[model samples]
Target: MTRRVPFAWFARNILVGTLLGGAYGAIHDQVSWSISPEYFTKFKFEQFAWAEIGLEPRLAASWIGFLATWWAGAIAAYAVCRMAFRHAFQDGASSWPLGRVVRRLLAVLMVAMAGGGCGFAYARMRAQDVERLWGGWRTYAGVQDLEAFATVGSIHNFGYAGALLGIVLVAVHIKVKGRVDRSSPQSLPPPGR
Candidate 1:
C-alpha cells in the first residue's frame, strides 16, 4: 500500500530545491568567470552579439545562464525526489528509517552527478563544434582549461551538493516529526485520575 505524503511536505521540498539550485547556479557561474574570464567572454560574445562585446553584456549572459540552469536543476531534483518517495511508499517503506533515507538520498546524488557529467560532455562537444565552425575565433589555452571549467562550472556540482543538503534537511525534519509524534497525547500516558 502506498502512503501519501502531505502536500505541504512536497511543496517545501520543491521550494528548498529551487533555492539551492539557484544558489548553486550563481556560485558556479562566478567561479567559472574567475577561472577563465576570456572563455566566458568569448562564449557569451558568440552566443549573444558578436559586435557588442563588453563586460556588462557578458555578466548579463552569465546571469541568464544561471537562472536557466537553476530552474532546470530545481525542477529535476524535485521530480526525482517525488519519484523516490513514491517508490518507497509503494514498497511499504514510508517510515523512512535513517539507513533507508540515506540510501535514497545517495541514489538521488548519484543521478545528479551522472547527469552533470553527461551534460559536461555534451557541452564540451558543442563548444568544440562551435569553435571549428567559427574557424577557431577564440583561442583556448588547452583542453584541460575547458575540462576544468566545465566540471567546476557545471550545475551538476550544485545539484549534488544541493541533494546532500536536502537529505540532511529531510533527516532533521523526520527526527523532529518523530519527536513530536511520540510526545503527542496519543502516545503519552493518560492523565492521572
Candidate 2:
C-alpha cells in the first residue's frame, strides 16, 4: 500500500532546510568577506562603484547571492528527503539501520556533488562575462587569474557548505520524527505486510 506522508513532515523539512541553507550562505559570505576584505572591496568598487550605487546595492547583491544559494540548497534537500522517504515506505526498508543510513548518505553526497557542479558552471559563465567586460583578470581586478576563484572559490566552497548543512539538517529532522509509522488510517502499510 502507498502510505501518505503528512504535510507536517514536508513543512518541517522544508523550513529547516531553508533556514540551514540561508545560514550557510550567510556564513560563507561573511567568512569570505573577512578573509579578503581588499579583494571584495576592489571587486565591489569595480562592479558597482562607477554605477553610482552605494553600499546598499553591494549589500543587496550579497543578499541576492545568499538567497539564490539558499533556495538551491533547500530544493535539493527537500527533493532528496522526499525521495528517500518514499523509497523507504515502498520497500519497508526504514527499519534497516545500515541500509537507511547508507541511502541517506548517498543522497546527501549526490546533492552536494550536483550543487558543486552547477556552481562551477555558473562561476565559469560569470568569469567569462567578467573577462569580456574588463578585458581579462589583470585589467579587471589586478588579479593574475580568476580561474581558481571561479572553480574552487565558487563551486567547491558553496557545494561543500550546502551538502554539509543539508545533511545535518535532514538528519536532525529524521531523528525528531522517528520512524515512518504506518499504523494510522491515514497511512498505508508496506506491500505484502
Candidate 3:
C-alpha cells in the first residue's frame, strides 16, 4: 500500500527545493541582464518597455508579470518532482510513502515558486532603477532595457530549469539503484539438483 506523506517531510522538501530554485533564478537573472541590451534599437523593442508610457502602470505590470512567471515555475517544479517520485522512486526498499512523497514534492514546488517570485521582484526593481537612471531609456536605452528584460526572463527560465534538472537527477538515481524493476525473481533451478 502507498504510504501517506508526513508533515515533517513536506516541510523539509519545500524548504530545500525553494532555496535551490531561488538561488538558480538569481544567478540566471544576473547573467542574462549582463548580456542583453536595454534597447533593441536595431529592433524597436524598446518601444515596448512600458516605462516610457507611465511609471505607475509599468510598476504594476512588472509586479503582476513577475508574480505570474514565478508561480508558473513553482508549479512546474512541483509537477516534475511528483512525476519523479511516483514513477521513478516507487517500489523500492527505501522508497517513501506515496502520499508523503506527493506532499513533500508539492511543498518543495511551492517554496521554489516563492523564491522564483522573489528573484523576479528583485530583477524588476533593478529595472526600475535603470529606467530612472537613464531617464526613460534614451541615454542607455538598449543596454538598460535589455538588462531589465533579461533579468526577469532569466530568473523565470532558471526556476524551470532547476526543477527539470531535479527530475533528471532523481530519475538517474532510481536507474542506478535498479528500482525500476520489481517483478518476482525467477525460481532457482530445481534446488541446484
Candidate 4:
C-alpha cells in the first residue's frame, strides 16, 4: 500500500507539466527553424495546415511546437509523479515535495534536448548517406532543401528517443535511491522491544 496523494497537487502538476512540455516544444521548433527554415516552410507548415493561416513562419513553428508537445509533457509528468509518490512511500516519507519533482523532471528535459542535439549532429555528419537514401522528402520540396528537412526531422525523432532514455534513467534512479534508503541504518528498528 502507498500513502495518499492529494488531488490538488496532482492537478497542479498536470497543468505545470503541460506548460513545461509546450514551452520546450515551442523553443525546440524555433531552434529547428534556425537550423533549417526549409524544414518547416516546405513540410511542417503544410502538415499542420499552418500555411493557410498566414502567420509568420517562426510564430507558426512555435505554435506547432506547443500544440505538438503539450500533451506529451502532461503524460510524462503524470507517470513521473506516480513513480515519485511511490518512491516516497517506500522511503517512509509522508509526501514527495513538488519542487523536487519538478527539478527531477527538468533533468528529463535536459536529456531530451541533448538527444535532439546529438540527432542533429548525427544527421549532419551522415547527410550524404541519409539524404541520398531517404528520398521520402523529395516529393515535398526541391532536392536542394533535402538536407535541412532531413536533419530537422532527425532532431525531432531523436528527441523522442531521448525522452524515453530520460524516463528510464529517472525510474532507475528512483528505484536505487529507495533501496539505498531502505537499507540505511536509520531505516532499521532498535533492538529492545
Tens digit per residue, CA lDDT, model 1, 26-89: 5656655665554455554455453343558446546644564556445644554555465334
Best by TM-score: 4
> Which stretches in model 1 have alpha-carbon errors above 4 Å?
1-5, 42-62, 90-193
lDDT of 3 at 113: 56
Per-residue CA lDDT of candidate 4, range 117-172, in tens? 99999888988886566686686475456777788899999998897788778767
- In order, candidate lDDTs are 0.52, 0.55, 0.46, 0.79
What is the alpha-carbon lDDT for the whole of candidate 4?
A: 0.79
Instruction: Report lDDT (Cα) of residue 154, candidate 1.
Output: 49
Candidate achieving higher TM-score, 1 or 3: 1
| Candidate 3 residue-wise lDDT at 1 | 28
Q: Which model is ahead, 2 or 4, in terms of lDDT?
A: 4
Output the number of the lDDT-best candidate. Answer: 4
Alpha-carbon shift of residue 85 in model 3 (angstroms): 4.2
Q: Write the per-residue lDDT of candidate 3 for residues 1-193, one digit (tens) a residue.
A: 2454444644444444454444444444344334443312322234345534443432434333343334444444455445544554444324554355444444545554554566566666777564554344444433434555545454555556555554555445545443434332532234656
Off by over 4 Å in 2: 38-65, 90-135, 140-193
Clash counts for all predictions: 0, 0, 13, 0
lDDT of 2 by residue, 138-180 (tens): 5656654445434445664657765866576556556444444
Q: Distance (Å) between predicted and true CA of 99, model 3?
A: 19
Local lDDT at 18 for model 1: 65
**Candidate number that wins on TM-score, 3 or 4:** 4
Model 4: ten consecutive residues of lowest lDDT: 87-96
